[model samples]
Target: MNNKIGDFKLYLSHELGLADNTVMAYLNDINHFYDFFNNKNMQVKSTDIVNYMNKLKSDGYSIETILRRLSGLSAYFDFLIKERLIDKNPISFISKPKGWDKLPKFLNFDEVDKILSIFNTNDPLEYRNKILIEFLYSTGCRVSEILNIKVSDVDSKRGFVRVVGKGNKQRIVPLYNKLVEILPSYYNIRHTYFVKGRDTGYLFLSRNGNKLSRVMCFNILRDACERAGIRKKVSPHTIRHSFATHLLTNGADLRTIQILLGHSNISTTEIYTHITDNKTREILTQFHPRFRNRGKS
Candidate 1:
Protein backbone atom coordinates (compact mmCIF):
# COMPACT_ATOMS: atom_id res chain seq x y z
CA MET A 1 0.00 0.00 0.00
CA ASN A 2 2.86 2.37 0.76
CA ASN A 3 4.49 1.60 -2.56
CA LYS A 4 1.17 2.00 -4.37
CA ILE A 5 0.60 5.39 -2.73
CA GLY A 6 4.16 6.41 -3.64
CA ASP A 7 3.47 5.57 -7.29
CA PHE A 8 0.32 7.73 -7.17
CA LYS A 9 2.42 10.63 -5.80
CA LEU A 10 4.79 10.29 -8.76
CA TYR A 11 1.83 10.45 -11.12
CA LEU A 12 0.62 13.59 -9.35
CA SER A 13 4.00 15.20 -9.84
CA HIS A 14 4.76 14.11 -13.43
CA GLU A 15 1.24 13.96 -14.89
CA LEU A 16 -0.55 16.69 -12.97
CA GLY A 17 2.37 19.13 -12.87
CA LEU A 18 2.47 19.42 -9.07
CA ALA A 19 5.77 20.73 -7.79
CA ASP A 20 8.14 18.24 -6.20
CA ASN A 21 7.91 19.79 -2.77
CA THR A 22 4.11 19.78 -2.83
CA VAL A 23 4.04 16.13 -3.83
CA MET A 24 6.44 15.21 -1.05
CA ALA A 25 4.38 17.10 1.53
CA TYR A 26 1.24 15.28 0.43
CA LEU A 27 2.96 11.94 0.63
CA ASN A 28 4.32 12.70 4.09
CA ASP A 29 0.93 13.78 5.35
CA ILE A 30 -0.74 10.60 4.07
CA ASN A 31 2.03 8.43 5.47
CA HIS A 32 1.60 10.04 8.85
CA PHE A 33 -2.13 9.35 8.76
CA TYR A 34 -1.42 5.76 7.88
CA ASP A 35 1.02 5.45 10.74
CA PHE A 36 -1.48 6.95 13.16
CA PHE A 37 -4.15 4.37 12.15
CA ASN A 38 -1.70 1.49 12.31
CA ASN A 39 -0.61 2.49 15.79
CA LYS A 40 -4.21 2.47 16.96
CA ASN A 41 -4.63 -1.03 15.47
CA MET A 42 -7.79 0.07 13.68
CA GLN A 43 -8.92 0.95 10.19
CA VAL A 44 -10.07 4.54 9.59
CA LYS A 45 -13.73 4.86 8.75
CA SER A 46 -15.25 8.13 7.52
CA THR A 47 -16.33 9.12 11.05
CA ASP A 48 -12.92 8.06 12.36
CA ILE A 49 -11.26 10.52 9.98
CA VAL A 50 -13.52 13.28 11.36
CA ASN A 51 -12.63 12.21 14.91
CA TYR A 52 -8.92 12.34 14.02
CA MET A 53 -9.30 15.83 12.57
CA ASN A 54 -11.04 16.88 15.79
CA LYS A 55 -8.19 15.36 17.77
CA LEU A 56 -5.79 17.50 15.70
CA LYS A 57 -7.73 20.57 16.79
CA SER A 58 -7.64 19.38 20.41
CA ASP A 59 -3.89 18.99 20.03
CA GLY A 60 -3.78 22.69 19.00
CA TYR A 61 -3.19 22.47 15.29
CA SER A 62 -4.76 25.48 13.61
CA ILE A 63 -7.71 25.19 11.25
CA GLU A 64 -5.56 25.96 8.23
CA THR A 65 -3.11 23.24 9.23
CA ILE A 66 -5.89 20.70 9.76
CA LEU A 67 -7.36 21.60 6.38
CA ARG A 68 -4.02 21.03 4.66
CA ARG A 69 -3.54 17.64 6.32
CA LEU A 70 -7.12 16.64 5.54
CA SER A 71 -6.72 17.78 1.95
CA GLY A 72 -3.70 15.54 1.61
CA LEU A 73 -5.63 12.62 3.06
CA SER A 74 -8.48 13.22 0.63
CA ALA A 75 -6.09 13.22 -2.32
CA TYR A 76 -4.50 9.99 -1.15
CA PHE A 77 -7.83 8.22 -0.68
CA ASP A 78 -8.99 9.44 -4.07
CA PHE A 79 -5.88 7.94 -5.62
CA LEU A 80 -6.47 4.63 -3.73
CA ILE A 81 -10.05 4.41 -4.87
CA LYS A 82 -9.11 5.05 -8.49
CA GLU A 83 -6.38 2.42 -8.32
CA ARG A 84 -8.93 -0.14 -6.85
CA LEU A 85 -6.90 -0.47 -3.69
CA ILE A 86 -9.83 0.84 -1.66
CA ASP A 87 -13.52 0.00 -1.99
CA LYS A 88 -14.48 3.67 -1.55
CA ASN A 89 -12.92 7.02 -0.62
CA PRO A 90 -13.36 7.37 3.14
CA ILE A 91 -12.34 11.04 3.15
CA SER A 92 -15.02 12.08 0.64
CA PHE A 93 -17.47 13.23 3.28
CA ILE A 94 -14.97 15.13 5.41
CA SER A 95 -15.13 18.94 5.39
CA LYS A 96 -12.24 21.32 5.83
CA PRO A 97 -11.72 23.36 8.96
CA LYS A 98 -12.41 27.08 8.83
CA GLY A 99 -9.40 29.38 8.60
CA TRP A 100 -8.80 32.37 10.81
CA ASP A 101 -8.22 35.94 9.67
CA LYS A 102 -4.65 36.50 10.73
CA LEU A 103 -2.45 39.49 9.95
CA PRO A 104 1.25 39.57 9.00
CA LYS A 105 4.12 40.76 11.13
CA PHE A 106 6.69 43.15 9.61
CA LEU A 107 9.34 45.66 10.57
CA ASN A 108 9.24 49.39 9.92
CA PHE A 109 11.66 51.27 7.66
CA ASP A 110 13.75 52.17 10.70
CA GLU A 111 13.80 48.54 11.73
CA VAL A 112 14.92 47.55 8.26
CA ASP A 113 17.70 50.11 8.60
CA LYS A 114 18.62 48.56 11.93
CA ILE A 115 18.75 45.11 10.32
CA LEU A 116 20.75 46.02 7.18
CA SER A 117 23.17 48.43 8.86
CA ILE A 118 24.32 45.69 11.25
CA PHE A 119 26.53 44.17 8.56
CA ASN A 120 30.14 45.43 8.44
CA THR A 121 31.30 45.99 4.87
CA ASN A 122 35.06 45.86 5.62
CA ASP A 123 35.82 43.04 3.16
CA PRO A 124 34.68 42.20 -0.38
CA LEU A 125 32.75 39.15 0.86
CA GLU A 126 31.13 41.25 3.59
CA TYR A 127 30.17 43.84 0.99
CA ARG A 128 28.64 41.18 -1.26
CA ASN A 129 26.66 39.54 1.54
CA LYS A 130 25.35 42.88 2.77
CA ILE A 131 24.26 43.80 -0.73
CA LEU A 132 22.56 40.42 -1.06
CA ILE A 133 20.59 41.05 2.14
CA GLU A 134 19.57 44.53 1.03
CA PHE A 135 18.55 43.29 -2.40
CA LEU A 136 16.34 40.55 -0.93
CA TYR A 137 14.47 42.98 1.34
CA SER A 138 14.32 45.70 -1.32
CA THR A 139 12.82 43.36 -3.91
CA GLY A 140 10.44 41.37 -1.60
CA CYS A 141 11.46 38.11 -3.26
CA ARG A 142 11.49 34.61 -1.81
CA VAL A 143 14.93 33.25 -0.89
CA SER A 144 14.70 30.82 -3.82
CA GLU A 145 14.15 33.74 -6.18
CA ILE A 146 17.01 35.75 -4.64
CA LEU A 147 19.68 33.06 -5.21
CA ASN A 148 18.46 32.47 -8.75
CA ILE A 149 18.97 36.09 -9.75
CA LYS A 150 21.49 36.60 -12.56
CA VAL A 151 23.44 39.69 -13.62
CA SER A 152 21.58 39.81 -16.94
CA ASP A 153 18.20 39.71 -15.16
CA VAL A 154 18.91 43.14 -13.70
CA ASP A 155 17.94 46.03 -15.99
CA SER A 156 19.35 49.32 -14.73
CA LYS A 157 17.53 51.24 -17.45
CA ARG A 158 14.16 49.74 -16.53
CA GLY A 159 14.93 49.67 -12.80
CA PHE A 160 13.61 46.11 -12.37
CA VAL A 161 14.62 42.49 -12.36
CA ARG A 162 12.67 39.75 -14.07
CA VAL A 163 11.84 37.16 -11.41
CA VAL A 164 10.50 33.68 -12.01
CA GLY A 165 8.20 32.87 -9.08
CA LYS A 166 6.23 29.79 -7.97
CA GLY A 167 4.65 27.59 -10.64
CA ASN A 168 7.16 29.07 -13.09
CA LYS A 169 5.27 32.38 -12.98
CA GLN A 170 7.33 35.42 -13.95
CA ARG A 171 7.08 39.04 -12.86
CA ILE A 172 9.22 42.19 -12.83
CA VAL A 173 9.98 43.85 -9.49
CA PRO A 174 10.91 47.50 -9.42
CA LEU A 175 14.49 47.78 -8.29
CA TYR A 176 15.51 50.10 -5.44
CA ASN A 177 18.22 52.49 -6.65
CA LYS A 178 20.15 51.97 -3.41
CA LEU A 179 20.25 48.21 -4.10
CA VAL A 180 21.20 48.78 -7.75
CA GLU A 181 24.15 50.97 -6.73
CA ILE A 182 25.66 48.13 -4.64
CA LEU A 183 24.88 45.30 -7.10
CA PRO A 184 27.96 45.94 -9.19
CA SER A 185 30.18 45.47 -6.16
CA TYR A 186 28.74 42.00 -5.59
CA TYR A 187 29.07 41.31 -9.28
CA ASN A 188 32.78 42.25 -9.11
CA ILE A 189 33.32 39.85 -6.20
CA ARG A 190 31.40 37.15 -8.06
CA HIS A 191 33.62 37.64 -11.09
CA THR A 192 36.71 37.17 -8.91
CA TYR A 193 35.31 33.93 -7.44
CA PHE A 194 34.28 32.62 -10.86
CA VAL A 195 35.80 29.37 -12.10
CA LYS A 196 35.67 28.42 -15.78
CA GLY A 197 32.07 27.35 -16.59
CA ARG A 198 31.32 26.54 -12.95
CA ASP A 199 27.91 27.97 -11.95
CA THR A 200 28.57 31.31 -13.61
CA GLY A 201 24.82 31.92 -13.79
CA TYR A 202 24.03 31.88 -10.06
CA LEU A 203 23.86 35.17 -8.13
CA PHE A 204 25.18 34.03 -4.74
CA LEU A 205 27.92 31.48 -4.00
CA SER A 206 29.16 29.77 -0.85
CA ARG A 207 32.73 29.49 0.50
CA ASN A 208 32.80 25.97 -1.01
CA GLY A 209 32.39 27.39 -4.54
CA ASN A 210 28.84 26.05 -4.65
CA LYS A 211 25.50 27.86 -4.81
CA LEU A 212 24.22 29.19 -1.48
CA SER A 213 21.90 26.71 0.20
CA ARG A 214 18.58 27.88 1.66
CA VAL A 215 19.71 26.78 5.11
CA MET A 216 22.87 28.89 4.81
CA CYS A 217 20.87 31.90 3.65
CA PHE A 218 18.49 31.45 6.59
CA ASN A 219 21.34 31.20 9.08
CA ILE A 220 22.95 34.32 7.68
CA LEU A 221 19.65 36.19 8.05
CA ARG A 222 19.16 34.97 11.63
CA ASP A 223 22.70 36.05 12.53
CA ALA A 224 22.12 39.48 11.00
CA CYS A 225 18.86 39.84 12.92
CA GLU A 226 20.65 38.99 16.19
CA ARG A 227 23.39 41.51 15.39
CA ALA A 228 20.74 44.11 14.65
CA GLY A 229 19.28 43.59 18.17
CA ILE A 230 15.83 42.98 16.73
CA ARG A 231 13.66 41.46 19.48
CA LYS A 232 11.21 40.02 16.98
CA LYS A 233 12.10 36.55 15.73
CA VAL A 234 13.43 37.19 12.23
CA SER A 235 14.23 35.05 9.22
CA PRO A 236 14.70 35.50 5.48
CA HIS A 237 10.92 35.64 5.22
CA THR A 238 10.90 38.51 7.71
CA ILE A 239 12.90 40.60 5.25
CA ARG A 240 10.30 39.84 2.62
CA HIS A 241 7.51 40.78 5.04
CA SER A 242 9.28 44.06 5.84
CA PHE A 243 9.68 44.79 2.14
CA ALA A 244 5.99 44.48 1.36
CA THR A 245 4.87 46.31 4.53
CA HIS A 246 7.23 49.24 3.95
CA LEU A 247 5.98 49.58 0.38
CA LEU A 248 2.31 49.49 1.45
CA THR A 249 2.97 52.09 4.14
CA ASN A 250 4.51 54.35 1.50
CA GLY A 251 1.20 54.27 -0.44
CA ALA A 252 1.87 51.53 -2.97
CA ASP A 253 -1.37 49.90 -4.10
CA LEU A 254 -2.07 46.28 -3.19
CA ARG A 255 -2.28 45.15 -6.81
CA THR A 256 1.05 46.65 -7.84
CA ILE A 257 2.78 45.36 -4.72
CA GLN A 258 1.28 41.94 -5.35
CA ILE A 259 2.71 41.97 -8.86
CA LEU A 260 6.10 43.11 -7.58
CA LEU A 261 6.10 40.36 -4.96
CA GLY A 262 5.03 37.86 -7.66
CA HIS A 263 2.01 36.66 -5.63
CA SER A 264 -0.54 34.86 -7.76
CA ASN A 265 -3.35 35.54 -5.27
CA ILE A 266 -4.26 38.94 -3.87
CA SER A 267 -5.15 37.24 -0.59
CA THR A 268 -1.54 36.16 -0.09
CA THR A 269 -0.46 39.80 -0.63
CA GLU A 270 -3.13 41.17 1.76
CA ILE A 271 -0.99 40.26 4.77
CA TYR A 272 1.16 43.33 4.19
CA THR A 273 -1.79 45.64 4.78
CA HIS A 274 -2.00 44.32 8.35
CA ILE A 275 1.61 45.28 9.03
CA THR A 276 0.79 48.95 8.31
CA ASP A 277 -1.01 49.44 11.66
CA ASN A 278 1.70 51.72 12.93
CA LYS A 279 1.62 53.65 9.69
CA THR A 280 -2.10 54.06 10.13
CA ARG A 281 -1.65 55.47 13.62
CA GLU A 282 1.02 57.87 12.37
CA ILE A 283 -1.25 59.10 9.59
CA LEU A 284 -4.10 59.71 11.99
CA THR A 285 -1.80 61.59 14.34
CA GLN A 286 -0.62 63.89 11.55
CA PHE A 287 -3.98 64.52 9.83
CA HIS A 288 -6.58 64.49 12.60
CA PRO A 289 -6.78 68.05 13.95
CA ARG A 290 -8.46 66.92 17.14
CA PHE A 291 -5.56 64.58 17.87
CA ARG A 292 -2.86 66.84 16.44
CA ASN A 293 -3.92 70.11 18.16
CA ARG A 294 -5.06 68.46 21.42
CA GLY A 295 -8.41 70.33 21.34
CA LYS A 296 -6.70 73.75 20.95
CA SER A 297 -8.72 74.35 17.76
Candidate 2:
Protein backbone atom coordinates (compact mmCIF):
# COMPACT_ATOMS: atom_id res chain seq x y z
CA MET A 1 0.00 0.00 0.00
CA ASN A 2 3.04 2.29 0.34
CA ASN A 3 3.66 2.59 -3.35
CA LYS A 4 5.63 5.70 -4.31
CA ILE A 5 5.56 7.85 -7.44
CA GLY A 6 5.23 4.98 -9.92
CA ASP A 7 1.88 3.86 -8.52
CA PHE A 8 0.52 7.40 -8.71
CA LYS A 9 1.18 7.50 -12.49
CA LEU A 10 -0.82 4.32 -13.09
CA TYR A 11 -3.65 5.81 -11.05
CA LEU A 12 -3.51 9.03 -13.03
CA SER A 13 -3.58 7.23 -16.37
CA HIS A 14 -6.06 4.40 -15.68
CA GLU A 15 -8.28 5.51 -12.79
CA LEU A 16 -8.43 9.18 -13.78
CA GLY A 17 -8.51 8.69 -17.57
CA LEU A 18 -6.00 11.49 -18.01
CA ALA A 19 -4.37 11.77 -21.41
CA ASP A 20 -0.75 10.69 -21.90
CA ASN A 21 0.38 14.34 -21.88
CA THR A 22 -1.55 15.06 -18.70
CA VAL A 23 -0.29 11.89 -17.02
CA MET A 24 3.26 12.72 -18.04
CA ALA A 25 2.92 16.26 -16.64
CA TYR A 26 1.52 14.96 -13.35
CA LEU A 27 4.31 12.40 -13.04
CA ASN A 28 6.95 15.03 -13.72
CA ASP A 29 5.52 17.36 -11.07
CA ILE A 30 5.24 14.59 -8.46
CA ASN A 31 8.78 13.50 -9.25
CA HIS A 32 9.93 17.02 -8.39
CA PHE A 33 8.09 16.79 -5.06
CA TYR A 34 9.43 13.29 -4.34
CA ASP A 35 12.96 14.41 -5.18
CA PHE A 36 12.67 17.37 -2.82
CA PHE A 37 11.31 15.15 -0.03
CA ASN A 38 14.06 12.54 -0.51
CA ASN A 39 16.84 15.16 -0.71
CA LYS A 40 15.86 16.56 2.69
CA ASN A 41 15.04 13.16 4.24
CA MET A 42 12.00 14.87 5.68
CA GLN A 43 8.44 13.64 5.94
CA VAL A 44 5.70 15.41 3.95
CA LYS A 45 4.34 18.41 5.84
CA SER A 46 2.25 21.51 5.07
CA THR A 47 5.24 23.77 5.70
CA ASP A 48 7.40 21.70 3.38
CA ILE A 49 4.78 22.07 0.64
CA VAL A 50 4.66 25.85 1.08
CA ASN A 51 8.43 26.09 1.26
CA TYR A 52 8.87 24.14 -1.95
CA MET A 53 6.35 26.39 -3.70
CA ASN A 54 8.13 29.47 -2.42
CA LYS A 55 11.39 28.07 -3.69
CA LEU A 56 9.82 27.56 -7.12
CA LYS A 57 8.57 31.16 -7.13
CA SER A 58 11.97 32.47 -6.03
CA ASP A 59 13.47 30.45 -8.87
CA GLY A 60 11.46 32.75 -11.21
CA TYR A 61 8.58 30.46 -12.17
CA SER A 62 5.67 32.51 -13.47
CA ILE A 63 2.40 32.66 -11.56
CA GLU A 64 0.77 30.31 -14.07
CA THR A 65 3.58 27.76 -13.77
CA ILE A 66 3.53 28.01 -9.97
CA LEU A 67 -0.24 27.47 -9.92
CA ARG A 68 -0.03 24.45 -12.28
CA ARG A 69 2.71 22.86 -10.16
CA LEU A 70 0.69 23.54 -6.99
CA SER A 71 -2.48 22.14 -8.61
CA GLY A 72 -0.61 18.95 -9.52
CA LEU A 73 0.61 18.58 -5.95
CA SER A 74 -2.89 19.14 -4.63
CA ALA A 75 -4.21 16.33 -6.86
CA TYR A 76 -1.39 14.02 -5.81
CA PHE A 77 -2.01 14.66 -2.09
CA ASP A 78 -5.75 14.10 -2.64
CA PHE A 79 -4.93 10.65 -4.01
CA LEU A 80 -2.78 9.93 -0.97
CA ILE A 81 -5.59 10.95 1.39
CA LYS A 82 -8.06 8.70 -0.41
CA GLU A 83 -5.66 5.76 -0.07
CA ARG A 84 -5.31 6.42 3.71
CA LEU A 85 -1.63 7.27 3.19
CA ILE A 86 -2.09 10.74 4.70
CA ASP A 87 -4.44 11.99 7.39
CA LYS A 88 -4.81 15.43 5.76
CA ASN A 89 -3.83 17.17 2.51
CA PRO A 90 -0.70 19.24 3.08
CA ILE A 91 -1.28 21.11 -0.20
CA SER A 92 -4.68 22.31 1.07
CA PHE A 93 -3.00 25.09 3.04
CA ILE A 94 -1.14 26.37 0.00
CA SER A 95 -2.94 29.30 -1.64
CA LYS A 96 -3.07 29.53 -5.43
CA PRO A 97 -1.18 32.53 -6.79
CA LYS A 98 -3.30 35.20 -8.46
CA GLY A 99 -3.22 34.48 -12.17
CA TRP A 100 -2.73 37.37 -14.60
CA ASP A 101 -5.94 37.78 -16.56
CA LYS A 102 -4.67 38.67 -19.99
CA LEU A 103 -7.09 38.36 -22.91
CA PRO A 104 -6.24 35.48 -25.22
CA LYS A 105 -4.28 36.63 -28.25
CA PHE A 106 -6.11 36.52 -31.58
CA LEU A 107 -5.82 38.12 -35.02
CA ASN A 108 -8.68 40.00 -36.62
CA PHE A 109 -10.21 38.67 -39.85
CA ASP A 110 -8.28 41.18 -41.95
CA GLU A 111 -5.09 40.15 -40.21
CA VAL A 112 -5.88 36.55 -41.00
CA ASP A 113 -6.55 37.36 -44.67
CA LYS A 114 -3.31 39.31 -44.90
CA ILE A 115 -1.42 36.35 -43.53
CA LEU A 116 -3.03 33.71 -45.76
CA SER A 117 -2.80 35.78 -48.93
CA ILE A 118 0.98 35.89 -48.63
CA PHE A 119 1.37 32.53 -50.38
CA ASN A 120 1.23 32.23 -54.15
CA THR A 121 -0.19 28.86 -55.27
CA ASN A 122 2.24 28.46 -58.19
CA ASP A 123 4.58 26.24 -56.18
CA PRO A 124 3.14 23.03 -54.73
CA LEU A 125 4.27 23.79 -51.17
CA GLU A 126 2.97 27.34 -51.37
CA TYR A 127 -0.39 26.05 -52.63
CA ARG A 128 -0.66 23.55 -49.79
CA ASN A 129 0.40 26.08 -47.16
CA LYS A 130 -2.32 28.47 -48.34
CA ILE A 131 -4.91 25.71 -47.97
CA LEU A 132 -3.56 24.76 -44.55
CA ILE A 133 -3.98 28.32 -43.21
CA GLU A 134 -7.44 28.59 -44.75
CA PHE A 135 -8.56 25.27 -43.28
CA LEU A 136 -7.34 26.26 -39.80
CA TYR A 137 -9.19 29.59 -39.80
CA SER A 138 -12.33 28.18 -41.41
CA THR A 139 -12.66 25.15 -39.15
CA GLY A 140 -11.46 26.71 -35.88
CA CYS A 141 -9.53 23.54 -35.13
CA ARG A 142 -6.61 23.37 -32.73
CA VAL A 143 -3.26 22.87 -34.43
CA SER A 144 -2.99 19.39 -32.89
CA GLU A 145 -6.42 18.39 -34.17
CA ILE A 146 -5.72 19.89 -37.61
CA LEU A 147 -2.48 17.96 -37.99
CA ASN A 148 -4.19 14.80 -36.72
CA ILE A 149 -6.63 14.88 -39.64
CA LYS A 150 -6.65 12.09 -42.22
CA VAL A 151 -7.60 12.64 -45.87
CA SER A 152 -10.64 10.42 -45.42
CA ASP A 153 -11.83 12.54 -42.48
CA VAL A 154 -12.90 15.34 -44.81
CA ASP A 155 -16.45 15.00 -46.18
CA SER A 156 -16.26 17.72 -48.80
CA LYS A 157 -19.74 17.02 -50.08
CA ARG A 158 -21.13 17.50 -46.56
CA GLY A 159 -18.99 20.58 -45.89
CA PHE A 160 -17.77 19.10 -42.61
CA VAL A 161 -14.86 17.11 -41.27
CA ARG A 162 -14.88 14.54 -38.48
CA VAL A 163 -12.25 15.70 -36.03
CA VAL A 164 -10.98 13.51 -33.19
CA GLY A 165 -10.51 15.89 -30.32
CA LYS A 166 -9.22 15.69 -26.75
CA GLY A 167 -10.01 12.38 -24.98
CA ASN A 168 -10.22 10.88 -28.49
CA LYS A 169 -13.74 12.29 -28.75
CA GLN A 170 -14.95 12.91 -32.29
CA ARG A 171 -16.90 15.97 -33.42
CA ILE A 172 -17.91 17.23 -36.85
CA VAL A 173 -16.84 20.80 -37.56
CA PRO A 174 -18.11 22.69 -40.59
CA LEU A 175 -15.49 23.18 -43.28
CA TYR A 176 -16.09 26.30 -45.31
CA ASN A 177 -16.68 25.42 -48.97
CA LYS A 178 -14.37 28.25 -49.94
CA LEU A 179 -11.55 26.58 -48.03
CA VAL A 180 -12.44 23.09 -49.28
CA GLU A 181 -11.96 24.26 -52.85
CA ILE A 182 -8.22 24.35 -52.36
CA LEU A 183 -8.09 20.62 -51.63
CA PRO A 184 -8.04 19.49 -55.26
CA SER A 185 -5.04 21.66 -56.09
CA TYR A 186 -3.07 20.28 -53.14
CA TYR A 187 -4.35 16.72 -53.63
CA ASN A 188 -3.10 16.60 -57.23
CA ILE A 189 0.43 17.40 -56.12
CA ARG A 190 0.19 15.18 -53.01
CA HIS A 191 -0.91 12.29 -55.21
CA THR A 192 1.82 12.77 -57.84
CA TYR A 193 4.98 13.49 -55.82
CA PHE A 194 5.76 11.89 -52.43
CA VAL A 195 8.56 10.12 -50.60
CA LYS A 196 8.79 6.34 -50.73
CA GLY A 197 6.49 4.67 -48.18
CA ARG A 198 5.07 8.09 -47.23
CA ASP A 199 1.73 8.35 -45.53
CA THR A 200 -1.05 9.36 -47.92
CA GLY A 201 -3.64 9.00 -45.17
CA TYR A 202 -2.67 12.25 -43.46
CA LEU A 203 -4.35 15.44 -44.67
CA PHE A 204 -1.34 17.68 -44.15
CA LEU A 205 2.27 16.81 -44.97
CA SER A 206 5.78 18.20 -45.30
CA ARG A 207 7.68 18.72 -48.56
CA ASN A 208 9.15 15.24 -48.00
CA GLY A 209 5.56 13.83 -47.93
CA ASN A 210 5.64 12.86 -44.23
CA LYS A 211 3.05 14.22 -41.80
CA LEU A 212 3.82 17.72 -40.56
CA SER A 213 5.03 18.30 -37.01
CA ARG A 214 3.55 20.96 -34.76
CA VAL A 215 6.82 22.91 -34.57
CA MET A 216 7.07 22.93 -38.34
CA CYS A 217 3.53 24.35 -38.55
CA PHE A 218 4.48 27.04 -36.01
CA ASN A 219 7.47 28.14 -38.06
CA ILE A 220 5.30 28.16 -41.17
CA LEU A 221 2.84 30.49 -39.41
CA ARG A 222 5.67 32.76 -38.22
CA ASP A 223 7.07 33.09 -41.71
CA ALA A 224 3.60 33.71 -43.15
CA CYS A 225 3.03 36.47 -40.59
CA GLU A 226 6.28 38.12 -41.62
CA ARG A 227 5.28 37.96 -45.26
CA ALA A 228 1.90 39.48 -44.44
CA GLY A 229 3.59 42.44 -42.69
CA ILE A 230 1.84 41.63 -39.42
CA ARG A 231 3.91 42.83 -36.47
CA LYS A 232 1.74 41.27 -33.77
CA LYS A 233 2.83 37.98 -32.28
CA VAL A 234 1.06 35.12 -34.11
CA SER A 235 0.76 31.37 -33.84
CA PRO A 236 -1.53 28.55 -34.91
CA HIS A 237 -3.63 29.26 -31.83
CA THR A 238 -4.14 32.79 -33.11
CA ILE A 239 -6.09 31.33 -36.00
CA ARG A 240 -8.17 29.25 -33.59
CA HIS A 241 -8.92 32.25 -31.43
CA SER A 242 -9.71 34.26 -34.53
CA PHE A 243 -12.08 31.55 -35.74
CA ALA A 244 -14.00 31.45 -32.47
CA THR A 245 -13.98 35.21 -32.05
CA HIS A 246 -15.25 35.85 -35.56
CA LEU A 247 -18.05 33.36 -35.13
CA LEU A 248 -19.08 34.89 -31.81
CA THR A 249 -18.91 38.40 -33.22
CA ASN A 250 -21.16 37.35 -36.10
CA GLY A 251 -23.61 35.89 -33.52
CA ALA A 252 -22.84 32.18 -33.35
CA ASP A 253 -24.26 30.39 -30.29
CA LEU A 254 -21.90 29.57 -27.39
CA ARG A 255 -22.91 25.91 -27.34
CA THR A 256 -22.22 25.40 -31.04
CA ILE A 257 -18.79 26.97 -30.73
CA GLN A 258 -18.04 24.81 -27.69
CA ILE A 259 -18.92 21.69 -29.67
CA LEU A 260 -16.93 22.86 -32.69
CA LEU A 261 -13.87 23.66 -30.58
CA GLY A 262 -14.29 20.28 -28.79
CA HIS A 263 -14.13 21.82 -25.35
CA SER A 264 -15.20 19.28 -22.71
CA ASN A 265 -16.17 22.18 -20.46
CA ILE A 266 -18.33 25.09 -21.57
CA SER A 267 -16.45 27.57 -19.38
CA THR A 268 -13.43 27.27 -21.67
CA THR A 269 -15.62 28.43 -24.56
CA GLU A 270 -16.97 31.38 -22.51
CA ILE A 271 -13.78 33.38 -23.00
CA TYR A 272 -15.06 34.41 -26.43
CA THR A 273 -18.09 35.98 -24.79
CA HIS A 274 -15.73 38.26 -22.94
CA ILE A 275 -13.98 39.11 -26.21
CA THR A 276 -17.29 39.81 -27.90
CA ASP A 277 -18.34 42.01 -24.96
CA ASN A 278 -15.12 44.02 -25.27
CA LYS A 279 -15.76 44.54 -28.98
CA THR A 280 -19.31 45.70 -28.24
CA ARG A 281 -18.01 48.20 -25.70
CA GLU A 282 -15.47 49.55 -28.19
CA ILE A 283 -18.15 49.95 -30.87
CA LEU A 284 -20.43 51.82 -28.47
CA THR A 285 -17.60 54.07 -27.39
CA GLN A 286 -16.84 55.05 -30.96
CA PHE A 287 -20.45 55.65 -32.05
CA HIS A 288 -22.54 56.38 -28.95
CA PRO A 289 -23.23 60.08 -28.54
CA ARG A 290 -22.89 60.08 -24.73
CA PHE A 291 -19.40 58.59 -24.94
CA ARG A 292 -18.40 60.68 -27.95
CA ASN A 293 -17.43 63.67 -25.73
CA ARG A 294 -17.90 66.08 -28.61
CA GLY A 295 -17.14 69.78 -28.13
CA LYS A 296 -20.19 71.89 -27.36
CA SER A 297 -20.77 75.57 -27.91
In model 1, pairs of residues that clash are none
Model 1 error, position 200 (Å): 3.9
Give all TM-scores, in the order shown.
Answer: 0.79, 0.83
- Model 1 regions lying over 4 Å from their true place: 1-4, 39-99, 194-197, 290-297
Predictions in order: lDDT: 0.77, 0.81
Give the clash count for each candidate. Answer: 0, 0
What TM-score would candidate 2 get against the native?
Answer: 0.83
lDDT tens digits by residue: candidate 1, 21-48: 6788898888777776775234468987
Candidate 2 lDDT over 1-297, as tens digits, reads: 225567788888777776677787877777787676665234578889878887888999876676677778788888878878778888777665555445678998889879878898787777778878888898899888899898899988788899987667799988887877767767787776643375668888887878888898998899999989999988898899999999999988999999899899999899889888888888888999977875753
